[model samples]
Structures are given as structure tokens and as C-alpha cells.
Target chain A: MEVLVTRQINKYFYEPEKFQVLKEINLTVNRGEFLSLVGKSGCGKSTLMYVLSTMDTDYEGQLEIAGQKLTGKKQDELSAFRNEHIGFVFQFHYLLPEFTVLQNVMMPALKQSKYAREDIRDKAMHRLKTLGVEEHAHKPSNKLSGGQQQRVAIARALINDPDIIMCDEPTGNLDTYNTHLVFDIFRQLTSESNQTIITVTHDDEFASKTDRIVQMSDGRVVV
Target chain B: MAGNRFQLTFEIAKVHLLSKPKQTIIAMLGVTFGIAMFIALVGLMTGLNDFTEDITMTSAPDIHIYKDITKPRQSILQQIYPNDMVWVYHQKPKNELTKVRNAKKIIELIRKNELVRGVAPALSSQVFCNYGPVQLNGYILGVDIMEEDKLFGIKSKMKEGRIEELLANREGIIMGKGLAQKLDTKKGDRVVITTPEGYTMTLKIVGIFQMGIGVIDNVRCYANIGTVQTILQQDPSYITDINIKLTDRHLAKKIAAELEAKFDTKAEDWETANATFLTGVIIRNIITYAVSVTLLIVAGFGIYNILNMTIYNKMKDIAILKAMGFAGGDVKSIFMIQSLIIGVIGAMAGLLIGYGLSVLISKTPFNGGDIISLDHFPVNFDLKFYMIGVVFGVITTAVAGYMPSRKASKIDPIEILRGQ
Candidate 1:
């Protein structure tokens, strides 16, 4: 089943001058597929990822995610939709530094407001245990090392059991060991739970290990 | 689910505020002092107003009934020489004064009313006091002694001799301290009193008192009504004014209106008698509110500045929260909750501080006869003042918070992430 589709997507930036940054892009991703978006810097890979994640609504495009048309939706509706069906991980592991790891993991589910708080807490603990960070669940996020923080971020992304997990450089700041560990976790999530993932990364080795890689150059997908 | 969302928002707001203790404390202090000043100053002003009303109402009757004095008829010469033309003419004898008639009947009618606590008929006349080759002119208020004393608390104000002495001897009079000094007379001294009608009589001074008002001490005296009427060669029933005390002083205006409509006479209540003082009270209140509200708004600006800086510093965090599926309203509510917490705590502290200050001021003595005539600074401990302070503080902080929250809500997540 196709989980996301983007057709004729175009984006422009008018900083010093008006210029097209994303040109007539077309893409689709199937459920349970672990895909990676790889490109050089300034190749519009991050821009396309942001547009697909429903974070950038300014692009002229049609975006359908999880069988719902998302284009032309109001900001609040998009926010609710994203809360229910999408999860995000960033390069910096954007966990609230003041919150415990467990609390940070439960943030998205709490915002969804569909489950009781105790149930959300139990699910959060379970996700942390799966990521092998349950021992540090009560510790503040800032107390953890870089690799541990990235793992916590991944746990947070899976807390809501979302249809799609969108990530920007999931292992960009990790060492080789942590990179392989994160890749193995993604593989297990795709094969066992059939969680769809779309990630943008600069690491060619990590992309090669994924199910498939979409390469981009100068705002167009080259392969 | 509803409870969970608020808890989430409150948790985030609490973390943000606690992380920057110095700025949050500064913002709280702004609201604190603003509310303190408002409560204290308003309390003091209200106390002063109450004090003034108490003094005036104690000294004067709640309502005074009298016939309206008619203006002198336009002179025939003024009729002929109109439009700013000046013409000199020989002065003619003045017409008879308009005196309140049927005084006995009116007094009887007023005394029968349930609202009337007491009614006293008073006849006042301008007179001259002569002794030892010195003649000083003054006004004499003729009263039934007991009734007038009850109406104006004159018995309590007597400084020398007894009010009953005036009632015992029809020829005895009570003169002001300064008037007695000017006449160089003491109690039991005889002074020749001459009315405006040129009738003279000898009267003994039985009492002397000082009313604290310079003009009243200098020119006022009291005598029996029969003596004054005999000196002026008027009938016993003639009286210039009727002073009526009411069951409730606040009902004076309403009673005065009814009396005026029923009796075809002008009635003056204490509120109308002290119009200038009432106007002063109203103007003072206006200035107090204006100054306090302005200061509070300035305090609100201090809160705004702090929150605005916090929002700017937290832009990256806000972007990530939005990317995590937190709605814009949720983001805005987090900041608003922080402001509300600060407002509530600050206002409570301010009320305590302001109340302590007011009590301290009320305890400090005036020591000397200051302009306000109060022995100490009057401070009212009305609960409404505290309520006003808390409400004002909360509203100010909320408004201050709203602007920065709106700015936080409008930030584009993608733009912030890109910048990062």
C-alpha cells in the first residue's frame, strides 16, 4: 500500500533573487518501505523532506499521506493530522533538555490526547525498553550522550505508532558503531512492525544499507 | 485527555520559566509593585474621603429646610439704564426679607414624619457686641438649646460653662472664644447686643467655645430663640431655618427632595451643602486611578519585554515542538500559562506588602495640626481594594503575555529548522 505520494511538486526561494529550488518533483513511497533520500548539500533534499513532512506548506504541490489529501488544509488541521499519522526525528535529537527521557518520549502521544496518561506512560516505557534506553528513562535528556540521545529521539518517533516516520540525518552526528546500530533498529522496525520511513542523510554507507535510496542532484532526482 | 493536554502545556511553561529564574522574578516584581501601589493609594484616598464626610456631616445637620431668599428686585434705574451702562442713583430702603412662615406648623408636620429623627427651628440674626468702648459685629444663632444640640452635637463641643446654663437663663448667651477675646469679656460678663433692626439689649455670656474653624470662632454666637426674636421685634413663631436630623444620613438627599416637593420650600442636604468638598473627592479619585493605571501599564511593558526576549531565545525549541505535532494553540497556551502563574503569585505578594504599608502609615501620628485635620493618615482596609489589586495584576500580566505568545504562534517551523 502506498503511504505517501507527491506529484509535480515545485518550490522557490527569493532571497537575493527569485529561483526555483525544487523543480517538477514526483515521488511515492510504499508502506513498510525503509527509504533514504541522499544528496549533496544544497541539492534540495532537505527542502523536499520538509515539504513531505507537512512542515512547509508554501510549496506548490499535491501531498497525500496515509490516504488523506493534505494540500490546501489549514494549519491547525495539518497539525492534528500530523499528530495522528506522522512522527519526526531531527539531526540534533531535539529532545526537551529539561524533561526526562521517558517524558520526552511520551510528548507526541500526550499531544495526540487519544490515550490515557497512564497508558501513554506504559507505552513510552515499552518503547524505551525496545530502544535499550529504559535504564535512563528517568534521567534528563541532556544527561545522556550523543548516541543515547539519538536512540531516545527514535523512541519518541515510534511512541504514537505513526504510519510514517520522517527523519533528517538520523545518524549524521553518530560514530560508525552508533550508525550501524541505528540502521539495524530501522531495519527491525520495517521488517517486524512494517513502519514506513523516509530519511534524508549525507552518509552514503547508511543509504546503501537501507531498503532503497533516492539520489538527488541540483533539485532533480538522479536515480 | 483534556487534563493531560493542559498538564503538558503547563509542564512546558513551568520548565521555561524555571530555567530563567532572574528574568521571571523581575517580571513578577513589576506586577507586584504595581498592584501594591494601586491598593495602598486607593485605600488612603478612600479613607480621606470618608473622614471629610464624617466631619462635615457631624458638624452640620443632615438636611436644612429654608425658604429661598429672593433677589432684590431690579432697580428702576437699572431697568432704564441697561446694557452695561453705568448710572448712579440714590439708594432706597431695602424690601422686607423673605422669612420662612408657618414655622410652628412646618415643625409640627416635619416632626410627625417617621424618617425625621429630630427637627429644630433656628432664627439667626446679625448683631453687634459692645463693651468697654469696643464694638464687634457677629452672627447669633438662636436655638431651642436641647434640639439644636442634638442636631449639631453642640453640647459635646462646648469648651467653657454648660449648654444647660443658656437654657436656664433667657438672658444668657454662648459666644465664640475669639469673639469673646475681641470683646475682652469672660463668662458672666455683660455685653450689649444690638440686632440689625437697631434694637439693643444686655446679655450675659454664660459659655465660650472654639469650633476649630477660624471664621466660626471669630464671628458666631448662640442665644435663646425668644431673646433673639424679642431683640429683632419679631413674632415668636418666626424662624429663619429648620434643621432636620434623619434616621439615616445617607437618606438625606432623598428626604430633602421629598420635603422640597411637598412644602414648596428649598431643602439643602449635607451632600449639596458640601458640593465643593464632594467635587474634590471625585477629582482626587480620578487622579488616583489615572496615575495607578498608567504605572501598571508601564509594569506590563516590563513583563512584555522579558517574555518577548524569552520567546526569541526559545524559537528553536518552539519550531521543534511544532514539528512534533504540537498545535500553534498549544504553543501559545504554554506561554500564557506561565504568565498566569506569575501574575497570581505576584499579586498575592503585592497585596500582603500593600496591606502592611497601609497599616504602618495609619499608625504614624500627624503630631501637628496638618492641613487635612486628621490625627493620623487614614487607611481603609476594605477587601475590595485587594480584590481590585489582584484582578488588575492578572489582567496586566495576561495582556503582556498575549503579544509574545502570538509572536511564538506565528513562527514558521521550517524557517527556524533551516536556520538551525
Candidate 2:
């Protein structure tokens, strides 16, 4: 079954004069598929990622995620939907500096409040253990190394057991060893839990390892 | 669900504030100083106002009724001519007695009214005091001693002898402190007083009192009404002034007007008689509120500046939280909760410090120097003023927080994420 779909998507930028950023884009990904979107800089791959994540709503398209149409939803409703169904990881390890690593991982689950606080904590600790960052959980997130913080960010994304995980250059700042570790985690998440993974990456090697690759040039998807 | 949201946001707000303790304390101090000053200034000012009012009310009656001497407007010619405009030049004044007619009957009618607390009929005459070599002119008022005491609490003002001594000795008089000093007479000394009509009488000084007013204490004395009547060679029923104390002094003006029309006498209320003092009180109150509000607004600006800087510093954090599925309202609530916490805590500390300051002021020694017998500074600790202070402080902080929080809420997360 398809986990995400976008039909004839278009986006524009009006600063310093109007310019089309994305044109006539259609994409689909099936459940449990690990998909990579590959393109050079300024090819609108990041813009398409933001639109698919529902964080950027200024676009002309029909977006369906988990069989639910999300094209005309209110911002708050979209936020709630994202909280429950979608998770995000960015190139930068964007953890709150003041919050402890464990607390940072527990934040989204706490906000969702679907489980008791203790259950949320245990789930967060379990995710941290899986990412091999449980020993650093009590320290402030800012105190962690770049590779360690990225792993913690992944742990945070998985705390809510979301249906789809979206990543924008998730290993862009990591070394080869840490990058391989993150790729293996994504592989296990898709194969074991049937969770869909979508990522935008400049690394052709990383794109080749994913289950499917969507290549883009200028603003259109190419074969 | 709402409660849970608030709790999460509040926790985030707490972490933000605690991360920079120094900045939070500085913002809190601004509100603290503003509210504290408001309380102390208003308390001391109103206390002084009440002090002056008390002195005035004690020395003067709420309403004073007497016959006014004036020239007749009609002059007989205008009344007989009716429609004609008659002019009279250098008109002589009409013969009218200064004493209120049927004073006892009028006092009885006034005493029957529910608003009248007490009525004291008095006869006053200008007298010349002769003590050995010195002769000083003064005014002597004769009153029923117990009634006068009940109206003005005269017993509290007596410094030398009891007011009851005047009743025991019909020939006794209670002279003012300054008058007794000028005459070089003690409480038991006898002084000869000659009325304006040249009738002389030797009266013993039974007591000495101070009203804390310079004019009254310098040239006024009190005696029995019969003694004054005998000295003036008047009848037993003669009364020049009727002093009325009311249940509520605010009712004096209306009751005075009614008494003037009913008794054909001139009546003056305390407020009309002391208009300048009342104006001073009003002006002081205006200044108090103006300065207090200005202080609170200045403090509010301090809070606004701090919150704005906090938002600027936390721009990345806000964007991340939004990207993590927190709504714009949650972001707004986080900042708002921070300011409200500061406001409530700061205001509570301010109230405590304000009460301490008022108490310290009230304990400071003050010398009235024969004008008034006060021993310490007066501070009115009115609960109403504190209530106003706290309410104003909270509202000021809330308004200050609102703008910055709204700006934080409207920030587009994609912009920050893309810029990074």
C-alpha cells in the first residue's frame, strides 16, 4: 500500500520577483520502503521534502499521507497529525540545548500524551538504547558530539512510533562511520517495523543503498 | 487535554527562565520596585491627609449655626416700589442681634434629627484679661461642659485639669495653653476678665487645654454659659452659636442648607468652611495615582524589553519546537507563562517589602512642636491600595508579555530552518 503521494505539485518564491521553485512533480512511496531523493543544490529537493512533511503549506498540490488527504487542513490540525503520524530529522541535530538528552527524546511523546509518563520514559530510554546513546541520555543535548546528537535526534523521532520518518540530509555532517551507522538504523526501521523512510541526500552512495531512488534535475523529477 | 498542554508549556517556560537566572531576577526587580514605591507613597500621603482632617474635625463642628449681621437688601423703598429699580447709596446696616433667636427650641429640633450626633449651644464674648500688670484681649466661649466634651472629646486635649472641674466650680474657666502662658497664670490662679460691655468678673483658671491650632490656642477660653451671660448682661436663653456634630460629616452641607432655610439662621458646613484643605487632599490623591501608574508602566517596559530579547535568543529553539509538532499557540503560551510567573512572584515580594517600608515610616519619631501632639509619623496601611497595586502589576506584565509572545507565535518555522 502507498504510504505517501503527491500529485502535480508546484511551488513559487516571490522575493526580488516571482520565480517557480518546483514544477509538475508527482511522487509515491509504498509502506516499509526506504526511499532517497537525490538532486544537486537548488534543485528544490529540500522544498519538496518540507512540503511532504506538511511544515510548508504554500504549494499547489494534493498531498496524501497514510491514506489521509492533508491538502486543506488547518495548521494546528496538521501539527497534531504530524505529532501522531509523521516524524522529522534534519541535517542539523536540532535538540533543545537546555533540555537533557532523555528529556529531549521524551518531549514529542509527552506532547502526544498517548501513554502514561512512565511508559513514555521507558519507551524513550529503549529508543535511546537502540541508537546506542542511552549512556548520554542524562546530559544536556548540547553537550553531546555531532554524531551522538544526531543519533539522539533519531531516537526522539522514533519515540512516538510514527508511521513515516522524513529526513533532510540526516547524515550530511557525519563521518563515513557514523553515516553508515545511521543508514543501518534506517534499514532496520523499515524492514523490521514496516515503517516508511524518505530522505533527501547529496551522497550518491547513500542513495544507491536505499530501496528506491527518485532523481531530480532543475525542478522536475527525472528518470 | 488543555491542562496537560498547559503543564508541558509551563515546564518549557520554566526551563527557559531558569537557564538565565540573572536576566529573570533583573526583570522581576523592576516590577518589585514599582509596586513597593506605589504602596509606600500612597500610604504615607493618605496618612498625613487623614491626620490633618482629624485635627480640623476635632477643633471645628461639622456644621455651625449662627445669626449673620447684614444690611437689608430691600431698604423698605424697594419692597414698597415693587417693580421699580430703586437705588440706595451708603446704606446703613439694619439692627439685628448676632444671637440666634429661640436658640433652645432650634437646638431641640436639630437634636431630634437622626443625623445629628450632638448639639451644643454656646455664648461667646470678646473679653480683656487683666492679670496684675499685663492686659491682653481674648475671646471667651461659654458652653455646657459635658455636652462640649461629648462632641469634641475635650478631655483628651486637657493638659492641666479635668473638664469636670468647671462644673464643680461655677466661677471656673478653662483657658488655652497660650492664653494661660501669656497671663502667667496656673490652673488654680484667679484672673479678672472684663467683657466688651465693661462688666468685670474674677474667674479661677480650672484647666488648661491645647487644640493643636495656633489661632485657637492663642486667644480662646471656655467657661459656663451662665458666667458668660452674666458678664455680657444678657438673658439666660441667649446663645450666639449652635454647634452640631453629625453621624456622617459628609452629610453636613445638605443638612446645613436645610437648617438655614428652616431656622432663618446662617449655617456653614465644615467642607465649605475648609475648602482649601479639601482641595489639597484632592490634589495629593491625583499626584499619587499619576506617579504610581507611571512607575508601573516603566516597569512594564522593562519586562517587555527582557521578553523581546529572550524571544530573539530562542528563535532556533522556537523553530525546532514548531518542527517537532508544537502549535503556534503552544509557543505563545510558553513565553506568556514565563512573564506571568515573574509578575506574580515579583508582586508578592513587593507587597511584603511595601508593608515593611510603611511600618518603618510609621515608627519614625516626629515632633509636632506644640502645634499638634503627634509622637510618630502616620502611615495609612489601606488594604485597598495594596489590592490596586498587585492588580496593576499583573496587568502591566501581561500586556508587556503579550506583544513579544505574539511575535514568537507568528514566526514561520521554515524560515529559521532554511536559514540554518
i-RMS, every candidate? 1.2, 1.0
- Tell me each candidate's RMSD, in Å, in order: 4.0, 2.0
Error of 2 at B328 (Å): 1.4
lDDT of 2 by residue, B13-38 (tens): 99999999999999999899999999
In the range A109-128, model 2's lDDT, one tens digit per residue, is 88887778889899999999
Native RMSD of candidate 1 (Å) = 4.0
Candidate 2 positional error at A20, Å: 1.3
Categorize the docking of model 2. Answer: medium
Each candidate: chain B TM-score: 0.84, 0.94
Stretch of 10 with least lDDT, candidate 1 chain B: B366-375
What tens-digit string does per-residue lDDT give for candidate 1 at B1-420? 688789889999999899889998988888888888888899889987887666667768889988776533567767887776766565565666546878889899999999889999998889999987999989988889899888878877788999999999999999988889889999999999988778999999999976655467778899999998898888888798899999998899999999898888888998899889889999999998887798789888998898899899888789988988888999999999988888888889889988988898888887424223457878889999899889988999999999999889988998877665
Q: What is the TM-score of chain B in candidate 1?
A: 0.84
Per lDDT, the best of the predicted structures is 2
- For every prediction, compared with the true complex, DockQ reads 0.68, 0.71
lDDT of 1 at B216: 72
